[model samples]
Target: MTSLALGPATPAATPRAATPPHAATPSGAAVPVTPAAAATRRPSEGSVHSWDLSTGVDGPGTRFVTFLSGCPLTCLYCHNPDTWRMRNGRRTSAASVIAEAGKYVRFISASGGGATVSGGEPLLQPVFTGELLHRMKHELGLHTALDTSGFLGVRATDALLRDTDLVLLDIKSWDPDTYEKVTGRPLRPTLDFARRLADLGQEVHVRFVLVPGLTDDPADVEGVAAFAGGLGNVSRVDILPFHKLGEAKWQALAMPFALHDTPSPTPERIAEVREVFRAHGLNAV
Candidate 1:
């Protein structure tokens, strides 16, 4: 596909050198803390968890995004393939993560934002994501969100939705065969999870990656719109433009780039798809 820019802006690199050690502030907190304070405070081990922090970009307010490790389905276009392996990531405790996340609570509150747990399929690490959200809300009083494909059977439970303030659910495709082709899995479970979440009256923002020749199909778009339209708890729909941002990552990891030759979707096409969702009364953004 055409060039993609996923995640946040990459920071400038610093040359490694022998120098004095210093403490670091938690990335994307609502407020900045002194280095001295960070150094004096014991870093919470947070279960040695594996998470890539994104300071903003995926919820109602300012957010500290976490890329939790592990996923059940192997979506061919997944950008973060490295997170698919559970054992490959760190295993930090919830307490430690909250302690570190707490350093940013002031920033979150001031900015009207909080933390988001995204993943290779965060529900794959339900206990971890749940525990972290629980602590963030109870201990730190911060809003919590979850970004998930909602494909796992046992992982889509009511308990998981309880701690979550918002659910960014990805609907890969409406057609089962096309979904299998794209994600190497079935579609029923994912759809079921969405409806179940909605039935429970949990707030949800439905997301669909606008992939040309795949998810852009009128039938697929219409199906998604119809399903979402019927949901009582679905508050909005987000149309994500597809891109090939992770092509280099594939090369770096010695993995094949499935969409290496695919072209990016045109602006006209994205607009047309947005019109479809708007027609269905689903707020498309």
Candidate 2:
């Protein structure tokens, strides 16, 4: 679910969540809860692209995956380019989102799972994302995970991470030049955010997409593995093999398919990469 945006034609069926009484305004203003602000800051809505009641992939067990719209990065391998636009999604309230997750909380919790908010970078909508996670943890007592590219990690607040149980962080590349080439964004911000997450004792699962030539350089892989290992808080490293699944998405969107003809890595290649991570004493899969 990393590169080449999957502009799925699932129809705008998912609902978004809204603001909390104590939260700041959407413009980052500190406003008291007034009738006007309440209506404007309505806790009943968020910009949600789609959702899925998933298992295994999104998080630990059964999960309520809410994919929000809007992202800053234009990764060459983006799978959800459809999510690249901001607020181009259905608006639902916080209550509505929680309600949907509530329907599966029992099954999720029973299997040591919970809800994960992903998107074109969830941090782009920090207020909505934070509020939703807070409720998921405090109100429903469900484990919460955030799947993000970390490009907008600076927008994340302390309160938000407190509610997050785990982070599915996608580290696109190691070298600054290559990172920028892979994603139309810099790498330091992501590294800074990863460091911050580690400093907070938050659990993190490092997700790396292994592109055939772009990111297969041994130096790049070693750099990432070493850096991740030093963090101490990284629980797992998932070396995802590159695929053409999202090529159709790119073509459908009329976006250039740079890696259109790229082949997926073989099992041995993936294992070799996994071994690189393991060499750093990391748990790789």
Candidate 3:
């Protein structure tokens, strides 16, 4: 689940022009639009990398996953290195994204799936993300999920969180040092976000990638499992085993793959890690 291949871009939806509330008077005088009304007419736009359909990996069922571009963390094992830069993405409006997702509303609804706003880091463009989530839930009549590292949790507004039905939070590592090593960032923010989600009673699925020699330490895994278990909002824990599916991506980007020599955890090791989560009274998979 840590690695998602970029899919084809959805056909562009025709951009709709915003209608100004102010009208011309018979005397040909124009009325000034209020600040609040102007804000409403402003379309939320973001840099979108790509989007794809996936089942069981993004959320509950098959989901219309939107992968926004740009991330603060340069994870050693990041698969989509192509999405690392915001400039690499195409500028897209939230309305266009919703229009694309709307096409599949009936199918997604029937399958018990919804829409997931994933990223290079969706929080990088919080305003656009919130718009997509809001429309996806209210307009599309679908469950909405946010796939985030939670590093930018502070950017998420309460209104944004209100629209999210579930959060697929990735706790790359539990130990602060290890977390920093795995992702060139601190761990406190993610933990803080988790706590906030717990307080808000937001549904969450904790995703942990088990990288050998880096994040495979039982204590570290236990640290994440324990923290997630303690958070009453965590509905399930996904023990994502590290894989080289994104190795070709790194090679294509000409970026050094630090874990090139590292091997994936065996089935038994994966099972063992899952047991650690189950021990903490969490539904681990």
Candidate that would win on lDDT:
3
Candidate 1 structure, TM-score to reference: 0.80
> Candidate 1, 124: how far from true, in Å?
1.2
Q: How many backbone clashes does candidate 2 have?
A: 22
Residue 35 displacement (Å), model 2: 13
Best by TM-score: 3
Clashes of each: 16, 22, 0
Q: Give the Cα lDDT of each candidate.
A: 0.70, 0.81, 0.85
Worst 10 residues of 3 by lDDT: 17-26
Clashing pairs in 3: none
Q: How close is every model to the real structure, measured as TM-score?
A: 0.80, 0.87, 0.90
Off by over 4 Å in 1: 1-57
Give the CA lDDT, 0 to 100, for residue 148 in model 2: 93
lDDT of 2: 0.81
lDDT of each residue in 1-285, candidate 3, tens digit only:
332444655445567623333422334344555777776675667899888777876999879999999999999999888888998788887778888888888988998999999989998887678778888988889999999999988887776788899999999998999889889999999999899999999999999999999999989988998899888888899988898888999998888999999999999999999999999999999
lDDT of 1 by residue, 1-285 (tens): 121123321222222211112222233112223566555654222222244334433676666666666778777778778777775456555554565567667866887878778777776765556666666766679888888887863464454466689988899888999999988888998888887787788898998888887788899989998888888787889898888887787788899988888778899998998898888788897
TM-score: the better of candidates 1 and 2:
2
Summarize candidate 2's per-residue lDDT along 5-35 as a digit string, tens digits.
Answer: 3232233344434455445445544344565
